[model samples]
Target chain A: MTVIRAALLGFGTVGQGVYEAIKTHQKRLQERLGKKVEIAGVLIRDLRKQRSLPKHILVTDNIEDILAIDDLDIIFEAIVGNEPCYTYLNQAIEKGCHIITANKAMFAQFGTKLLEKAKQHRVQVGFEATTAGGVPIIRTIEQLLQVNKIEKVEAILNGTSNFILSEMRKNKLSFPDALQLAQERGYAEADPTNDIEGIDAFYKLMILSELIYGGQPEWRTVEKQGIRTLTSEKVQLAEQKQKRYKQIASLTKKDGKVLASVKPILVNKAHPLYHVEDVDNAIKLETSLIGTFTLQGPGAGKLPTASAMVEDFIYVLEKDKSIKQQGEVVYS
Target chain B: MTVIRAALLGFGTVGQGVYEAIKTHQKRLQERLGKKVEIAGVLIRDLRKQRSLPKHILVTDNIEDILAIDDLDIIFEAIVGNEPCYTYLNQAIEKGCHIITANKAMFAQFGTKLLEKAKQHRVQVGFEATTAGGVPIIRTIEQLLQVNKIEKVEAILNGTSNFILSEMRKNKLSFPDALQLAQERGYAEADPTNDIEGIDAFYKLMILSELIYGGQPEWRTVEKQGIRTLTSEKVQLAEQKQKRYKQIASLTKKDGKVLASVKPILVNKAHPLYHVEDVDNAIKLETSLIGTFTLQGPGAGKLPTASAMVEDFIYVLEKDKSIKQQGEVVYS
Candidate 1:
């Protein structure tokens, strides 16, 4: 059997999830790719920490060590931040490695550069896990754009913020109380500033805008607001009027100008995002030909995020196989 | 510019919609495929009838005349019924012309055979318009099945039935009255037997079953019921209980067996298909990896359905281009 050697750039929650999914769904992976997928190495911050990683995979604190693996076909990056993640993936691309990433922060800023580099290197880039977790919004937009022109997009993009808002409205709890409850339920992080301040959704919304309109609005021009200021009384008042407060990321194109924003809005029952509660995410797209369409799924999760990466892995490998079969150079 | 010659196999509402879509979206087609798509011929059922078709394109009542068009790269089939439609497409496939069809009755019965023949002749088949009109459920299922095992699918697949049911509940009208109103509103046909008797939904359900589970249950084993027998009193009673009567097509795979059915189901407010009223359609799928995901869109319309066919046409032509670039014989 042909073994497709791959490496993990950051072995955190998402990295562990990918490792576990690849281990468990090996049979399915083989059936799809006609090859065995093997995790050759893992890049971790602390090699001395007690971990549950299986044997036969090299654990290293240095990325160069992991990238040095022979014939590495794919690199699954689940790292955070902008600097090192960007630099590391750029190097991986230089090594002719296909990338499947779940790092939205790094991707939102450097995605275009990385894609250009990948094209020059004749490699593929898969970032389906970067936005909306398990919702195949990226692929959906790609397919829809082939024939239709997307006019507007309204979406619930962040799970942590949505869960907090849902808890606040449903329980009549204050923002602090809802944040505490979300943390207790593992829906929010210890330092939920990024999610609470709407930065996370802003990055995702920018990603969607770039995908649809081929470019995003100026960063400072995008009006970004969070749910921290929403009071329980206001939420109650909205509920009394048959409305719900949701963190909505909106993008609209009018007369060739694209406007993007992320904020909490009061939506009535008729709004599709009105009923989207807790960790669920939904994207409502108004297109030129098909009118209105919406897709809803888990916005963030271990398995769901991992599923997106694996799907991307299968996609990248299939594309590679076709390119190789055709004996042609790939420029994707 | 390279001209891609195409033919229309039927000239009903869907055929006209396809023609208009092609004519209006010519720029988009050229951008996506890098070839100018030109309709060389259209097969109409009547010759002397007053029609507004363009003079340059060939119009004929005979299928042979349209099939005889030289270098016809694609055929769009929107004919009703099962016999001549199936035979016409079969002959087109034998001529190595790609096909995009919106005929659910013909497709649901002979789709597998047609696809097999197309494969033998090195042609592609696009049937995204066959089920759920503009929903794109077929493409969604195809992508999801790459990794996840879809355990169950519950969908509102028929728009006319849903529209009539929505009218009966909201207006407290009788079944016949609501159906008549649907016809008057152009939501239902004058002879609404297929839409009211659940056969339309049944055929679409079987199409989904074939795509997901590889084959559908024996037609006799499937339990099919439409909204024809639904009473206004029952609908009102359900509405009082915060429920709505929806024509749901359900398919479940458990214990290595697949069961399929189409029935008027009472759905609560929490159900994804509950608020999917009027001409809207929604499908909720329970998968092994991504959990529960739902897609909602227009269930039926000239523009929406034509959008799907155009999307398929673009897909077929792109695949053809890639295959030609690959210098290989296509088996699909």
Candidate 2:
């Protein structure tokens, strides 16, 4: 059995979840893949801080320790933001190490460049966890787009916004109350500007657009709207009309041009997005060959997000094996 | 590029869709897989029927055409029902030709035996298109179960039943009217007993159980319920209570025992399945690692079902390559 050596870049919520998942499902993973995956190192901001982790696994604050590891096959980047994650990923790629990341901010800006670089280095870079947590939307779309022409990709991509909206509709709470409830429940961050202002969804939309449509729509080109403008009266009115308010992010290809947007729309009770409440996300794809396909799941959470990262890890391992077996094949 | 030769058994809806999908997406498939997949021959019950097929493609009524073909790498059985499809798949396995099928009935009954035979013969058997059409649920579950312990899998597996329920909820139609409307829309067959009686969902549930949970839930063991018992009064009452009715098929591993059932349940406006109306099917899987993950799509349509067949073909091809590369591995 092949043994894949991996390292975690950030030991945060998702990173810790990945560690737990790997430990909890080690035997199952080994049986399924006919290989053992071992974590060689973990990189965090603080080295002195105590963490719920095995002492046998090396923990370091320096990037050089992870980058310099000769046996490290892949890097799992659960770090937030762009600058340092991008730098670490680039270094990993340069070292001919494959990567799986849940960082959407870096991907939204530098995905193409990273993909190109990985291709140049003959390595894999998977970003399935960067989207809808455990929905498998990225891989599903990759499969569908291989056989079908996708016309429109629509999704309730942001769980925080969706939770806030669902709360507003159900409890008739004002935007402030709903946001506060979300933050208190740990669904929203203390500063939830990226989610509430639609920037998070916008970033996801940009990533999906680039992936499915093959190029990013200029961020400013998207007609940005958020759930913040929704009032309690509007929420109540939607409920009265048997509708639920949802923030929808959509990317459509029309005449070879991609149109992307993020907005709060009142979907009727019959619409699928109307029922996806709380910290759940749903994506609906309209393709030429297969018509419509939708996937829903926990959009953001410790386990679900980490499961996605594990999926990407498995994908990278499989791709690595395939490439090794069939040299000079264009995998991407 | 490696070229894989294949044969198609049956010229039914799914078979024709596979043919057309292959022809339409040949370039993309070749680019992605680094191989050209060609249909070497087609097995049909009657060759005199007026069918639109490429003249270069040979159409024959005899199974010998597929069996005798020396270069055929795989056989795609799109034939419905048990006896003939099973016989042909077994023949393919014996002949050392990998098999792909959209025949759920055969798989539901004899998947273990067939997979054992394939393993013995060093071949592959793919049945992705058999359940949930083109949603790729089987593959997703296979991947997830490899890395996580699945707790439960609940799904609106049959599209016909989901359509009837959705129509009943939306248009306030009686069960009979809704079913008739489904037939009129081509979502249901003339003899819709298998679909409406919950047998279809049962079969899919069995497949899921075997594939993910590693054992088949006895067909009779599952408490089966269908939409025929649903009344418009209940639909009205559900709407009055701000709920919707959905036909749900579920399999759960609880306390080391497998529990499986197909029944109609009342879900409030908050449930994702509530909004999955009009021929749409949704599946929710609760796992130890991924929490709750749901997939919704056109469960049974001409193209969607056909897309699944294509996926099965690709899966077979990839697995065949892998098995050939790896001399022998213990089968779990």
TM-score per candidate, chains pooled: 0.96, 0.94
- DockQ, candidate 2, comes to 0.52
Which residue pairs collide, candidate 1? none
- Across B1-332, the per-residue lDDT of candidate 1 in tens digits comes to 39999999888788898999899889988888778999999998878887787798999999889888989999999888997888999999998899999989888888899989987888999999998787788888888887788999999888899999988988999998998899999988879989888898889888898899988789999998877778999999999999888998999987778899889888887787887878888899998888889999998888889989998898787676666655543432
Model number with the top TM-score = 1
Global CA lDDT computed for model 1: 0.88
Which ranges in model 1 have alpha carbons more than 4 Å from their true place? Answer: A323-332, B323-332
For every candidate, the chain B TM-score is: 0.96, 0.95
Candidate 1: tens digits of C-alpha lDDT, residues A174-279: 9999999989998888999899988999999888888999998899999999889999999999999998899999999878889998999989987889888789
C-alpha lDDT of residue A325 in model 1? 53
For A1-332, candidate 2 gives per-residue lDDT tens digits of 37878899999889999988888778867876787879889999988888877776778999998887767889999998997889999999999999998999889999999999999999999999999887788888887776788888879999999988888877888999999999999888889999998999888888898888889877778898888889999889878888877899988977778888899887875566777878889998888877888788889889888888888887787777766655423231
Q: Which ten residues in a row have the lowest lDDT in candidate 2 chain B?
A: B323-332
Location of the lowest summed lDDT over 10 successive residues in candidate 1 chain A? A323-332
Where model 2 places Cα greater than 4 Å from the true spot, the runs are A1-3, A328-332, B1-3, B327-332
